[model samples]
Target: MSLPMTCRRSSPRLLSLCLAIAGALAAQSAIAADSSAATETSDDAAHPPASDTRHAEHAEKSKRAVDLDTVVVTASPLRTTAGDLGKPAAVLAGERLDEDRASSLGETVSSIPGVQSSNFGPGVGRPIIRGLDGPRVSVLSDGLSTEDVSTVSQDHSPAIEPFLADQIEVLKGPSTLLYGSGAIGGVVNVVDGRIPEEAIENGFGGRAEARFFGGDQDGTTDMARIDGGTDRFALHADAVYRNAKDYDTPDGVQANSFIDTKSGAVGGSLLGDWGFVGLSASRFEDGYGNPGEPGDLSAGERGVHLQLRQNRYDLKGGLKDLWGEGNGLRFSFGHTDYDHIEFEGDEPGTTFTKNANEGRVEATFGNRDAWQGAVGVQGTDSTFAAVGEESFVPQTTTRGYGAFGIARRSWGDFQLDFGARVDKVKSEPDAMASRDFTPLSLSLSGGWKLGENWRLTANLDHAERAPVEEELFANGPHIATLAYEVGDPNLDKEAANQLELGLQYKSSLVDAKVSAYYNRFKDFIYLVDTGDQWYWDEENDYLPIRQWSQSNAIFRGFEGEATFHLADNDSGRWDLRAFGDTVRATLADGGGNVPRIPPSRLGAQLRWENGDWRASLGATRVNRQDKVATNETPTAGYTMIDAHAARHFDTGNVGWELFVDGTNLTNQVGRVHTSFLKDDVELPGRSFDVGVRVFF
Candidate 1:
C-alpha cells in the first residue's frame, strides 16, 4: 500500500518517510532470513565449557533480563545504573513504559514520585519537578537540549513525541552538575534510539503499533520504527502520527482542546571495534487549540490555536580505548530550526521563531570498582524572535559555555561522589544591553550499605541558575496566560543550596525506597501578582498585571515508593505497589506561599503478571491545596482511577501484542494546581485506549 496523493503533496519529508516504510516492508522477507541465520549462529556460539556452565547460564539470564536498577542511564556521562547513582533517578522502559505512555511527555512520566505535570490543556503538559517548572527544569532528547521555546510560555508544548521513545529517564533532584544551569531543579531525558549505538542482533528488526482512544477523547495514533544493519553499518527510521478531537470534561466538551501531530526521523551509524559514529534528522509538526481562550461565536470571537514546526539534525560519535583500556571519549552536536504561529480566528496573531546550535564533548576514565570520573564541556548558541500582535518578548540571542567534572570513588561498602561546574551565560536582546552571568555549582553525595537488605544515602548540592529570556526581558500582554507581564532587566542569577537523605530496603518479598529533601534559595525568581490590571481597549477588559520578582525562599519535599511481592505461583505473579509525594514552598521571610505548586498525592497499584498476560489496577488521591500566594485561589482535591491489561503472543515468525488502557475511570473533575488554566480547564474525562502492536 502507498500513501495518498494528498499526503505525498503535503510535504517532501512525509513522502520520503512513506517511501522508506514501503521499502522496509518489501525487504522484510530477506531480512527475516538473515535474522534467522544470525540467531542460529548466536545460539551456537553461546555454548560454554562444562566447567563454567553454571556461570555461563547466569550470565545469559542477566543478558536477557530487564531490570530497572540494572538499566544504564544514558544521561550520565559515566554510564552508571540507577541503583549505583549517588542521587535518586527513575527509568521507564519496556512493558512498563508501554503501559504508561501518554500523548504528552509530562503525563508519560508523571507517575514517578516527586514529578507532576503542568497542564494548560490536553494539548500542553510540561513536566514539573519538586514544585519547580518553566525554566528551572530541563527537557532533553537523547541527552541534548530539545531547543524548544516551551520555557517561554505555559501554553507551548514540547517538540518531542513520547510515543517513539525507547526509554525515558528522570533525574530527580538538582542535576546542574551535569546538565548545566537549566537543570538546577532536575532533568528529563527521552531516549528514542534513533541513532543506534550497537548492531541489531537480529540483523533486521522493527515494530509497528496502532491505537484508538474512546470515551471523552476520540483519537487515533499510529507509529512505526525499523532498525537494520550489519556489524559495520546500521540504519534506523521512525514515524508517528496522532489526531484527537476536543475532549470532554465533567462540565462539558472542552471547546478548543483538540490536537494533531506528525513526526518522523531517519538515522544511520557506522560501527567498528573502536566505536561508532551516527547522524540523524528529524521533523515535528503539531497543531493544537487553547481551551483557556475558547471564543464565542455570538461575539464574533475566534478560538485561539497554535501551529508548531521544527526541524532538527544531530551528529554523535564515540571513541573507545582513547587513553587506556577503560577510557573513552564521546561527542554530540545538534542544530534545530523551530517556529510557531498563534492564530486568532482565521488570522495569524503572533509568530515565534528560534534557531539554535549546541555541542558537547566528554571523556570518561577509570573503573567502577575503585574510582571513575568524567569531564565534559558544553556550549550553546540560540536566537529567538517574536512578532505580530500578541508578541510579548523582544528578539534575543543567547550564548552559553560551561565545563564540568564528576568523580566517584568506592571502598568496601561505602561510596562517595562529587562534582563541580562553572558556566558563563550571556543574553543579548535586539535593542537592549546584553546581560552576562557567571554561575558555579557544586555537589557531594555519599552512600553506605547498612546491611544485606538495607542502604542509606545523603546528598548536598549548591546550584546556581542564570535568568532566562522571559524572566529578564518579557514585557506586555500574554493572551494565553491572560496577564500583562513585566520583567526586570537587572535581575540577578538564582542560587540554591539543597540537602537530601534517603533509605532503601530490598528483598525477595519486598522492595522500597524513601527520600526527604530541603532547598534554600538565595535569589528565587517568580511571577508576582502586582495588584494592578491592564485595560485592553480591543478586548474591553482588564488583565491582571504580573511582574517578575526575586526573593529568598525555601522548599521542602518527601517522596517514597514501595512494592510487595504478594504471590508467585500457578495463578500468576502478583505485586502491590504504593507511592506518595508532598512538597511545600514558601518565602523565607514569610511573605507568602509559592503559587502553582502541585498538590500532595498518594497512589497505589495492584499488578499481576503471567507467562503471556499482564494487568494492573491503580488509583491516586490528590489532596486539596490551600497554601497559595497572594491573589491565588485554592484548588479542591480529586481521586483518579486507572487500569491496564495486555496479552502477548506469536504468529509464525512475528510477534504481536494487544493492550488496553483505561484512565480516569471515574471521570473525576480534577484540576491541576500547577496549571495556568486550571480554573478554566478540567482534566479529560474517562477514556479507554485500545491498541495492537506488531514486532518483526
Candidate 2:
C-alpha cells in the first residue's frame, strides 16, 4: 500500500500544492486541523483498528492536533508505525480544519518546516515539500498511487477529494528514505479510514458539514459528508460544490484569479478486524485565471478553464501471520481515469487523458529488539494523450517498476536505518522510438541516544527521475496567461545526489531540529522560452536548430525547526505550544537559481487550550529572491499573518465532536513569492466557515 498526500486550494484562497498529495500546488492556504491518530502493528499481524479519515476543508473555527492526537499506521507497504517515524511530523484533525477556513490544505501544510505551496488558483493548489515537486513527489490514495494529471505538470490538477480524508501526515527530511528515491525531500500522506477493520456490531456513525464565505470576494461551499458503521460493517460518502468571484488586490485591482469551481463525490466500503475493502469516485470542474503578468493583455485566454473528471476504485486486504505469528502482508491495486483541457490565447485548446493503473505489495520480518527490514514492489502503467498537438509524446505510454528495502537495528546505545531502492523505467511513444533506463538510489541514517533528552541524526540520499510528458512533449498555449511552450523531445531525466546532517533536542518543555544539505544535478530538465511571437519553445531542447539535447545544473539548501510545549503534565490546561520552521536555498556558484524557488522562509505560532476552547496565532515571512541565475528567473518576497480560535462540544461518543470556526481575522493580503507569475496574482483576500465532525 502506498499512501499519498494530495494538496488542493482551500477557502477562496485554498492551497496550491506542487505535488497532488497536498496536490502540492501554489494556491493552497491554511486550514485548521481535521486529523486523527494511529496504532503500531507487529511484523506479521494485522492492526486492531485504524485511525479516522483526515478530510481537507476550511472552517472558521480552529483547534490543535493534540486535542485529537493519533498516529497513522499502514502509510506504505512497510509495517512502519508512527513510533518508527522517530523524526519530526505533525497530524491535523477536525476542529483544526474548522479554524483555518481561509486557505486550503497546502496552505495549512506550509506552516510546517521545509514545506511550500504552488498556487494555480483558488480551486487548485498543491504542496511542495523540502524543495521537491513534480515526478519526484508521489500522491497516493490509501497507499495506492493516484496516477492522475496532477503529477503531469504544474498547470494540471489532482484527482483526490480532500473534503473526505480521515487524517493528514507530513514527514520531513531524510526520514522518508524508505518511501522512494524521489522522496529525498520528504513525504506527506493522507489517511482515509473509509475502509473498516473491525466488524460493526449494530450502530453506525456519521457527520454533516456545510460552509459559506462572502467578503472582498464571494465564496460558497455545499458539502455533505458522512461515515458510519454497523455491527460488522462501516462505510463513508460525501459531496461538495464550491465557487468564487474574482478577488481584488490590496490596491483594489481586479486580479483575474477569479474562480468558478464545482465538485461532487460518492464512495463507500466494508470493514473488518483483519482489514476492510472499498471504492470511491469524484468529479471536478472549473474556470480560473492569473493577474499581474508582463507583456500585452492577451485575448480570451485568462486562466485555467477545464471540464475535468475522474473515477477510481481500490481493493485492499490486510493479513497477519501469513505462515505464522508476528508476520503480515498488505496488498492494494488501483485504477484511475482523468481528462482535462487548457485554453490559451488564439492557441487551440490542449486536452489530455491520463489513464493509470498501479499495484503494490510489501512483506516485513517481525521480532522485538531484533533486526528488521521490509521489501516491496511498485508498478505503474500509464498513457499520456494530447489533442491536436504533435511532438515527442502527444500520445505515449510509460511504465515504471521499483523495488525497495529498509532495515532497522539497535546497537547498544545507538540505532541505525539503512535502505536502498532501484527503479526500472521504460517508455514507448506512439510512432516514436522506444526508451529504457534504470535509476539507482540509497539512503543511510544513524541515531545516537544520549540520556533520552538529546540525540543526533545524519542522512544521505542519491535519487533520480525520468522525463515526464510535459518535459518531453509539452507544446501549446497556456490558457490562463496566453503563453506557449513547445516541448523538447530529446530531454533526459534529472538526477540529484544530496547529503544532509542534523542535530535534535527534546526535553520536558522544548523540541528542536536543525539540518544542512547539498545537492548536485546532472542533465536537469527545466522549461525555458524560445522568445518568438511570445510563442515559446522549450529552449534547452536544441540550441539553434533541429536537434536533441538538454541543460545541466545544480542546487543546494539548509533547513531547521523548533517547538516549545508550555503546558506541563500537571496542568489540565491542555496545549500551550510555540513552534517555528525555516528553510534557505542557493544555487551552485555558476548555476542559475531554480525558477520559482522561494528564498529563506520563517514561521511562528502560539497555541493554547483549556478544556473545550483553543486559540492560535500564526505569522510567516518569505524573503524576496532577486538572486537570478544565468538562465533562472527571480521572485519578490512577502509576509503573511493569520489567526484563529475554536470551542469543542463533545458528543459523548468515543470519538465524536462538533465545532464552529472563524478565519483571516485581519484578512491579510496574499502572495505566493516563489510563483513564476506573482506580480498581480495575489492570494485570496480573506474568508470564514463553520463545520461539524464525528468518529466511532
Candidate 3:
C-alpha cells in the first residue's frame, strides 16, 4: 500500500519507529514460543495453574472496598482489564450503567473524566472526547461501526440505543491502531450482547424494565430482553420503546423538544467445543423535533423534525486453538441500510440514505507468561446520498481497507505494548474526481509498577486520517447551521502526534488515576467563517458563508479521578469520589483558540451501599468558557446536582430492582459550549426518573 503523503514526505521518523517495533515484536514472538515450551514445567510451579491463579485473583478482588476498576474491557482485542491497560480507558456496567443510562449515548457516558456531550437538544447528543467531535470519534456496537449519519451533521443523533447496552467502553486519546484512521481522537464501544457467544447458564433468562420521567421532561420507556439455549445452541432477543414530550427549561418549556423511538433485535448462535458462530438482525426507528429551528407558532409556521430508520444484519464466528493451545481466530461482518428524512412540519424536506457493509478477521496468539498479541484486517464499503432542497452534500461512494497488528509483553514490574495500522481510503463523488488517501497510525505504551499500590504509565501515538465525504464535496446550504457551506476537494490528510503520561494508585481504601496529554496536529481540518454571505430569495435573507479549511493546531488536557472508601461497618459502606478535567485547543501560528471547546469541570459524588440498598448524590461545576475563536461568543457556565437510589429484592424465582434518579435538581439553566444551539436553547431542567427492573 502507498503511504500517506505527509508520512512519505515529512514523517520518516514515525514510519521508522513503526517498522522497528514490528521487527522487534516478530523476534520476540519466536523467542516467546521457544521459552514457553522450554520452561513450561518450571513456570507452572512459579505461576500456578490457570484456575488456581484465577481463584487467587478473585479472592484478592473480593477484599477490595471498591470494585469499579476490576471490570474487563471488551473493546480490546486481548480483553484487558480496565485497571491493567497501559492507555487510558473506562468501563460502565452493572448497577452503575443502569443508573447512568439516558436518552442518548453521549448523555449516558458524559460523567466519565475527559468525556463530554455535544447537544443540539434533549433528543440529540453525541460523545465528544477531550476537545474533539464529529468524524474524529468512532461509535461502535459490539465492535462494529454503527453506520449512522450522525457524523454528517451536528444535529443528528447516533443510531445506537444506550439503554440496551450490557457494557459501555471508552478509550481516550488516539485509538486509530485498533479501530480505524477515523478514530484518531477516541472510541466508544457499546456492548449489547445481542448475539450470544456462549450458551445461557441456566438454559433460559431474561430482563424487563419500565421507566417514567416527571418534572421538566415527561417521558416513558419500556424494554425487554431474553436469552435461551440448549447445550449446543443459543438464542437472544430484545426490544425497546420510548416517547417524550417537550422538555422544560429554567425559563420555560423548550419548544419542539420531543422524541419518539423504537428498536428491536433477534439473534442466534451455534456452540461447540471447538468454536461458536452467531447471526443477528436488528432494526431501529426514531423521530425527534429540532428545538433550534422551532418555527413561530403565532405566524403559523411549522417546526422542523427528523425521522430516521435503519435495518442491520450481523454475522460472527470464532475458532479456538487455531495454531496452538492458546491461539484463536475470529471474524465478524455487518450490513446496514439507513434512511433519514428531515421534515418541515408534515412535509419532507431533505432525504438522506446510506447502504454500508463492513467486515474484519483477526487472529490472536501467545502465552500469558511471555507475550500476547493480535493481528487483524478490516474493510468497509458504503454509499451515501442526499436528495432534497436542503441537501448540501452530493452523492458519494467511500471504501476503505486496512491491516493492523498489536502486541503486549511484560518483564518483572514493567509492561510494554506496541501497535501499527495502515489504511487506504477512496472517496468518489458523483461527476467529480475521486480522491484516495493512505493513512498510517502507530502507538507505543508502557507501564511501570512503582510499588505495591502505585503505577506509572506513558503513551506515544502518531495517527493520520482522511477527510470524509462532506469535507470534500459539500457545496450548498445547511439549514441545521443556518449557513452556506463549502468544501475543498484538494484537502490533504490530517495527521497528529500525541504524548500522554499517567499515574495510578490502588489500595483497599483508595483508588486514584491522573493523566496529562498533549497533541500536535498538521493540516487539521475545521470550518471557518469567511465574512461572506449568500442571499437566499426563498428565505428573503442572507446566510453566513462557512468553508472547510485546514490549519496547524494543538490540544492539551489533564484529567483525574479519585475514590475514597470512607467506612464499612454493620450500618453500611460509604464511599466518596472526586473528578476533574480541563482541555484547551488552539490554532498554531497565533490563530487563537478553537471554537466550541468544552470548558473545565470539577465534580464529586458520595455513595452508600448496605445489603440490597444503594444511593448516591453528586454535583458538578462547569467553568465559563471565554477563550473564544475569531468572531465566536463566550459561554456562561453553571452548576448541576444529581441524585440516584435503588433497591433490590427477590420474589419467588424472579429478582426485582426499583430505582429513582434525579438530574439538574437545582433547575439551573445550562448551555453546552459544543452545541450549535447553545444561544437559542437551554438544557432540560429538574427531571426525576423512576423505574423498575425485573430479572428471571
Candidate 4:
C-alpha cells in the first residue's frame, strides 16, 4: 500500500523479488508439513498402489507438469484440463507456437508470464494483461468474438491470425466467468481448428510454411493449410501472405513503417457419431504504415495511414452423449464485414465501418461423482461508422446480451470452481447519445494437491463492465495515441474485484509455477492527461488532452515459472529456464501512476535437444519504469539477447522444419514502456529469422 512519491523508486531487482517470494513461501510451508506427516502414515492408505503406481508412472508426468495435456476451452465451459483451470494459465503450442508466430498478436503472446505488448507497430499489436489493455482484453477466434475494431484503438489491428494459430490460450485473471464483459482483462483464446470439431486425421491433413526476415525490416511469409474427411464430411483450408519493409532501429529505418498482409480461409463439416456441423469463410487484407509520423513531408502530408479489411462468416455446432453421459451441446455463429481507410498523406483521411453479428450457446451437464459444468447464451450485433475528416466515434450501434455459467468439482485432492454472469449492453449514437448497461458477474476457484509434487491455487472475482465505443464516444484527433481525444457520455458501470494466489510444482526433474494477483476497481476507466490543448495544424502544433476518465483503481501482480531437467539420456536433453513478471498500478484515491504500466521482468533460458536437433539461448532484464503519470515520461531499462536454431525432417510422407532466429542480439535501444509508440518507436534492431516448415 504505497507508491506515489512520484511513484517511488528503488530495486535490487525488487530486492530479488522479495527474496524469491520469501523462498517460495518458506518452501511451501515445508511441503505442507511434510504432506501432513505422510498422510498420517500407514504408508499413506497402505500404499493405494503407491498412489496408483505413481499415477501409472507419472502419466507422462502429468502432461509434463502444467502442460497438462492442453485442453482448455477458454477457462472452462467444460473442456477442462490445464490442471482443471483454476486460473493463471498459458499455452501456445507446438514448435514453440510455430517459432513464436508474430504478425502482432502482441508479438505473438509476448513470451507469456503475465504478458505484455501494446507495441503498436510491426502492424499494430495489442495484448497487455496485468495492466489491462483496451476493452479489457478478450480476443477470441475459434471461440467466436473477434468482431474487431481492436478494442477501438491503439492503432487497431487484431483481426485474428497468428499464422493461423492452432493453439494460443492464455487466460490469466478475472475471466468474467467465461468470456463476457470482454473477459475483464483476460482471455486470448485463438485456437484455429477451422470447423471440424473432430475427425480428419489420415483422411488427409496438411500444412506448409515459409519465412524470411533480416534486419531493418526485410520480410516475407507464406503459409498454407488443408484438411479432409469423409466419415460424413469435413474439410478446411487456409492461406496467408505477408510483406514488410520499415523496421530496424538502432536509430534508423522505422519511417512510415511498412507492411502488407493477406489472409484466407474456408471450411466444411457435417460428421456425426453424436453430432457436428460447421461452416466458415474468412478474408482479411491489410496495408499498413503509420510509424507515428516522422521525416520528409509531401503528398499533402498529415500522417496516419491504413487500409484494412475483413469479411468473415461462420457457424458451428456440436453435440455428444446427448442427454446422458457427460451430456453436451455447443454452438457458435459469427458474421463480420469491417472496413478501414485512413490515409492522410494522400487523401481519404477517414472511413471506418463495421457490421457484425455474433451468437453462442452452450450446454453440458454433470460429468460425474459430483458435478461438471457449462451453460450459456451470448449475443451481439454491431454497426459502426466513421466518415471523413477524422471522424471520431459516432454513427454507431452496439448491442450485447449474455448469460453464463461454469462449474466444476472434485473430491480427494480437492478442487472446485464456480461461475456466473449476466450482461446487457446497448449504445446507439446515430445522432448522438443513448446508452444502457446491466452488468453482473461472479467467479470462484480452488485447487489443492500438496503432495505428489505440490499444488495450490485460489481465485476469486467479481466483474462488470460496459462503456466502450472508445469509452463512450471519443471526440477528436488521435494521431495514433499522440492524444487529443475525449469521451465520457456520463460514463459509469465498471466494477471489479479480484484476488488470486497459486503455487505448483511437479517433479520428474522439476517444473514450477507461482502466482499472485490483486485487483480492485470501481469506475476505473482511465485515459487522462487533460493539460488541455488541441489545435492540430501549422505543422502539428497542439496535441495533449486525453480525457475519458473515472477513478478508484488498484492492481498488483507477480508471476513466475521455472523449469529444469538439465540432462536426460538417449543422446539428447538438457534444459533450464526461469521467468519473472511484475505489475503495480495505482490511483485508488491517491491519484498517481497507473498509466502505461509494465515494467520489471527477469528471464533466462538454455536448451539443447536431440532427435533432429534444436537449440536455444535467452536473456531478458527490463526494469526501469519510474512509476510515472503526471506528464508521464520515465523509462530506461534494457537487456535483451535471443537465439534459436532448429532442424527436423522425416519425408516419409511429409514433415520438415528448419529454423534460425535471433533478435536484439546486442543491438539495443529498446523502448516499450507499454508503448504508445514509446516516444516514436524503436524496439527491433539487429534481427534475423529464417524458416521453413511442412507437415502432412
Candidate 5:
C-alpha cells in the first residue's frame, strides 16, 4: 500500500526566486518617457511635463492649478462613493496588476489585506479570504455565477477567463445577498463590460494582450479579443491559449505545472434607451492534474489526466434606467455543457461527463435610495455519466430551484439590510436511493454612524448547503484528490448561523476596519478519513469501503485592516502609502480547527510615485501555527519582503507601461496553518515574472 504525505506549501523558495529575475527583466525593458509638456516623465528622469503651457499663461495669471477627483462605485453599496465604501474593500487597477507579474487571480489579490491562496500546483490556486473558501465565497462575472467545479472541490479549476475582465471587485461581507444564498463568508466579482465603444459609432473596437511567466513552469498567456456594436445590436469575442511546463520548487524540488488550457467566448447585445438585450457563449478546455509530493501518494504516484470541456450560453438584459427612473430590471436565462473525464495513461484516456442548464430573473427597485429592494428566481438541471470500456457509476441527474429576496434601508444614521431565500434540490442515480434536500437561508444587517469618520456595523446570517451527488453517493476512486471517497446517500443538509460586528474609520490620511464574528453549525458537512485505502469494485461498490456522517461545529474569528497615506505632494508628482491586515479563527469541540483556514498574518508596503514613475517595497509576516485539525498539516512561521519600480510612457494618445516586480525578498520559508496537507506539499520559494501593459 502507498502511504500519504503532506507537502509543506509555505516555503519562500519560489517567492524569492522571482525577486532575482526582476532586475534582469527591468533592465531588458528599460525605455524612458519624454518631458516635453505633454510628455510624461519616468523615474530615471523628472521635470513635470512643463505644466501643459497651452493654458499655462492664462491659468498662471489666474493662479489656478489642475485638480482631479476619484469616484468609486461597486455592486456592494447602493450608490457610488468617494473611493471609500465605508466597508473593507480594495480597488486595484489593471495597470498595477501588470507590475506584479502575478500568474493566478489568487496570487494577484493575495497582495491585498486579509487574503491568502490555496495552491494545488504551480498552474492552479484559489483565493482564501479571512480563512474561508469554497461555497462560502462566490465568484462571478457580470452578475452571473461561473458554473465550474471550483466551488465543489479544491482540485477543480474555475472556467471563467480572467485576462478578459476589465476590473475585479472583492466584497468582503455577507453583501452577497443579491448574488445568491450560502454566501455568508464574502464575494468576488470579476467585471467585464463585454461592450465595444467603437461599435457604437464606427461599429467596432478591438484589443490584444499577452504576458509570459518564465519561472519554473516556463508558461505563457497569449490572447486576442474584439467587440463591436451598432444602433440596436452588438457583438464581442475572445480567444486565448495558456501553456506551461512542470514547475520547480525551492531547493529545486521537482514539481509539475505542465498544463494546457484553451478557451473562447462570444457575446452580443441589443441596445435601447430603457433596457438592453444580451447573449453570450463561452467554452473552456484544459488538460491538467495534481501530482504527489515526494512520498505523498494517497491517490498514487501517477495522477489522473484531465480532459475537461465546459461550454455555456447566456441570454440577459437589464434596464439601464427603468421603473420610472432611478430603478433597474435584470432578466436572464443561461445554459451550460460541462464535461470532465479522467484519462487512463500519462495522458487522458477515459472520462466522465456532466451537462447542466440554468435560468434566472431579477429586478432592482432603486440604484440609490434610503430604501431599496429586489427579488429573483433561479433553477438548474444537471446530468452525469462515465466513459470507457469499464463503466463505473451509472447515469445520474440533479435538479435545483430557488427563490430569493433582498431589501435595504437607511434611516437617521443607521443602514439596515434583510435578505431571505428558499431552495429545493433533488438527485437520482442508477442503483442508488434517491434523495431530496430543502434549504432555507436568511441574512440581516444594521449599521450606525458614530461620526463623520466612524461607524459601527453588525450582521446576522443563516445559511444551509446540500451535499452534492458525488459526495453523497460515490463508490469508487475519484482520482482528483487521490482518495477513494465514499458517499452517504442518507446524509443531511448542513445548516449554519453567524453573528458579526464591525467598526470602520476613514480619514484623509488614515483608514481602519475591524470585524468580529461567531458562527454556529448544525449537522455541519465535513470529510473524514476511513483510515483504510481500498480499490472499490462494482459488486462491492456501495461506497469506497467507508462510511460518512455529519457533525456539529462552530467557527469564530476577528480580522483587522489599516491603511496610511504616508505622504502626497501637491505637485501631482509623489504619493506614498502603506497597508496591512491581521486575522484569527477558533473552531468548535474536539473536531479540532477548521481545515485550510488562514492564520494570523500581517503585511505592509511603502509605495512612492510621481507622474509616470513608481517604486515600492513591501514586507509580510505569517505567524507559525501548530494547532491543526485532523488530517491537517502544520507549517512553520515565516516572513517575506520585496521591492520594485516601473515607468509609464506615452506617444500621441496611446500609452504603455513597463515594470518589474520582486517577491519573497527576505527569503523566508514559512508554512500555513490552513492546509490539509501542508507538511508534504510546500509553496514555491522566491521567483520572478516580468510583463508590460498598453492603453489605447
Candidate 6:
C-alpha cells in the first residue's frame, strides 16, 4: 500500500536551527513590535470633523505635515496601526500612492520592499510576494475577496478599480489566520470608502485629477471622487476612465497593446455614536488586447481582445458596546457577478463567468484581564463556468465556511499575540468527482521593546491550503500561457511552516528595519513541464505540456530599508534612503529551482522638501537571474534611473498640485523575468508624465 501525498510532521533539525538564530538575536537587542516604514492614513488629516467648525477653520488655515505611522485594518479583524503588527507591513496613500499609480495594481506598488509585479502587459498584472505568486497569494478589496478568475491564468486582471482607492496595505509574509487558506504567501488589501464608514464633514468635498503620459506610446486618464453628508447621513461617489495605445519597444511597436477601462461606485450610509450602517453598488468594465509575439499568429487569428465586466453590491454595519460590557459587533456582505469574453478578430472564442457571495460577522471584546482580540465567522459560495473553445476546466461550484480568532496580551516590555482558524471547503465539478477538505491554520508571535530606540520581533505560523478547482480539473490547452495543462484529482492539501525575525531602530536622526524569513512546505502543488509538446490543429503550432504535481519546497529571503535625516532646518528638509531585497526558492525533493523567481534588487534615493515644492532622484539596479528550472532559460538584468518634481498651490477653496514624473531616464532596455510576456514585450523606455490634481 502507498501513502497519500499530504502528511503532518515537524522538521526537528530545521526548527532547532531557526530557534538558535532567533535566540541569539533576542540576546543582542529587543525587536520593535511594528515596522516604521509605513505612512499614516491621509483621510483623517485631509478631512476635519464636521461638529467642530472652529477646528475645521483652523485646519484650512495651516496644512499639517503627513504622518509616518498609519492605521491599518488588514492585520486583524480589529483595526491596528501598521507599526503594531508583528510582520513586515507597508502602507501606500496620499501623495505617494498618487505618484506611483499605474493601470495595474501590481505595478502601482512594485517599489515596495519584497514585492514584485507579474506584468502580463499594461492590461493585466498581479503581485508576487517573496517568491510566491499565482494561487498562493491573495488579493482582496477592503476585507473580502475580489471573486475574479485572475487566479486561473496570468493574463486575467483582478476585477477591481485602483484609482478610487484611498489606501493600499501590503503584508509581506504569512498572514493566513486572518484571511484564510490562500494567504500563506501574503495579502494585498485595497481600501476604499465605497460604503461610507463615517459621515463626511463640511457638507461636501471632492477631487478631480487628469493626466497625460507619453513615451513610445500615449495614454490619457481621468478620475473624480465626491462625498457629502449631514451629521447622521453620508453619500459617496467616484469614477475613473483610462485609455492607452499600443506601447513601443526598443525593436519596434509591440503589437496589440492597447487598453480601455472604466469603473464607478455609489454608496450611502447612516452614522451615529453607536457605529454606522452602509450600502454600495459598483460596476467595472475593461477591454484590452493581448500583445502576442510578432510571428505567433494562427490561421484566422489576427488579434485577441478580452472584454471583462463586473458588478458588485455590498452591505456593511457595525454596533459599538452592544453584546457585552466592552464588546462590539461588525458585519459585512458582498455579492459579485463577473464575466469575460475572448474575441479573435470578429469571432468569439471563449466566455468565462463567475458568481460569488460572501458574508462575515465579527465580535470584538475589549481588554479584560490580559487578553484582547476578535472572533468571527465567514461563509462564501461561488460558481464558475466557461463556454465555447478553450474551455479548460469544467463547470464547478465551491462552498466554504470558516471560524477564526486572534488575541493579544501585553506583559512588561513584551507583547504576545496568537491566532487560529479552521475552514471547511467543498468543490463540485459537473463532470468530475466531488472533493472535500478541512484545513487548519495557526500563528504565534512576540515583540520585545528593547528600550526607547530598538525592538525585536519573531513569528511562527502553520498554514494549510486545499487545491482550487483549476488545479483539480483542468485538462486542456491554455493559449494565454502557451501551455497544455493537466490536473490531478487525487491531489492532497498543502501545508507550510514558516518563521520570521525582524529588528527595528527608530530615533530622531534615522529610521531602519531589517527582516529575514524561511518557509518549508509539504505537498506543495505546482505546475511542471513534462518536456512534451502538443500541436494545435493541423497548423503545427505547438505548446509545452504541463501537469499539476505535488512536491516539497522551501523559500527563504531577506529584506531591509533605512532612511537618514540629513538636514532639517527652516529652509527645508533633506533625506537619504536605501533599500534591498532578495529571495531563493528550490524544490526540497531535488526537482530543480523554481521558475520565474524575481531577481535581487537594490535602490537608493535622495529627496528634498521645501515649503510647497517636493523633489526626488533615485536609481534601481536589478541583478541578473541565473537560477533556472529544467525547462526555463536565464534572464539578464538592467539598471534604471527615475526623477520627480511637484509644486503645490493654494487657491482659496481649492488646493492643487502640478507634477512631472520621469521613468527610465537613462533609456535602458530591460526585461522583467517575472512577466509571462518578457520574451515578446520590452518594458517601457524613457517615459514622462505631466499631471495636475485639485482638491476642494
Displacement of the residue 47 alpha carbon in candidate 5, Å: 37
Ranked by lDDT, the better of candidates 5 and 6 is: 6
Provide the TM-score for each candidate, comma-separated.
Answer: 0.93, 0.80, 0.91, 0.33, 0.80, 0.90
Per-residue CA lDDT of model 6 for 1-696, tens digit only, reads: 111111112234323323332342332122112212212222211122221222222234233233334545444565666777776788776666777788888888788889988877788878899978877888888788889999988889898877877777888787778777878888998877777766554455566566677886688677777666655777888888888888876677777788899999999888776777899999999988888533234554558889999999999887767755456788889999999998877678889999999998888876645778899998999999988777888999999899999998888778898999999989999978999999899999999999998889999999999899889999999878888999999999899999999998888898898999999999988888899999898457998999998899999999988989899788678888899999998998678987889999999988888777788899999889989777787788888898888877655444567788888888888888987678777777788877766564
The reply for model 6, stretches above 4 Å from the true place, is 1-65, 293-302, 323-326
Best by lDDT: 1
Model 4, position 419, has a per-residue lDDT of 80
Clashing pairs in 1: none
Worst 10 residues of 5 by lDDT: 42-51
- Tens-digit per-residue lDDT, 1-696, candidate 5: 111111122124322323322332232233112111211212100111111211221122222212111223334424334233434455443444444424456666776666777666644566677666776677666556666666545656666666665556666655434554435456666555553211232343333444455453366665555544454666787776777666555656545345788888888777655456777888888766554423223555554456678888878766644564556666667677777765544545545566777777776675344667777787778777766632334567878888888777778788777888888888888888888888788888777999999888887888777766656776665444556666778888877787878887788777777777777878765666666767445435432333455778776667666667666675333334344454444345566665556766677767666666677777777776666666556677777777777666554332344656666654455444554335545555665555454332
Q: Which segments of model 1 are wrong by more than 4 Å?
A: 1-26, 35-65, 297-301
RMSD of each predicted structure = 5.3, 8.6, 13.3, 23.4, 10.4, 13.9
Question: Tens digits of per-residue lDDT for model 4 on 1-696?
Answer: 222121133234333333333343344344434432221111110111112222222223112222433445443556665655678878776656776788888888888888887877788888888879878888888777788787877887888779987668878877866778878988888877778665554355556566778875588777776665555776888877788777878988777778789888898888766667889898988888878764355553645679899999999877776777657778888999998898877677788888989998888887657887878888998988888766778878889889888888899898898888898989998777699998899988898998889889988899988888877888988767877789998999888998889988878798888899889889889888978888888555888889989998989889897888878778677788889899898987689888889897898878777777778888888889998888889989988888888776554434456788888788988888977888878877888887666554
Q: For each predicted model, how many residue pairs clash, with residues at least 3 apart or on different chains?
A: 0, 106, 0, 1, 43, 8
Candidate 1 lDDT, 1-696, residue by residue in tens: 454343465345445544665566558766766554432211110111111211121222111114577667889887777787889999887667888888899999999999999898887888999999888999999989999999999999999999998778999888999989999999999988787776665577677777778999998788988887877777898989989999998788988898999999999998777777899999999999999988875788879999999999999887877777667898999999999999998889899999999999999888867788999999999999999977788999999999999999999999999999999999999888899999999999999999899889999999999999988899999988899999999999999999999999999999899999999998899999999999999989999999999999999999999999999888988999999999999987878998899999999999988777789999999999999999999999999999999877664444567889999999999999988888889998898998777565
TM-score, cand. 1: 0.93
Best-performing candidate as measured by TM-score = 1
Clash count (model 4, backbone only): 1
Ranking 3 against 6 by TM-score, winner? 3
Candidate 1 structure lDDT: 0.86
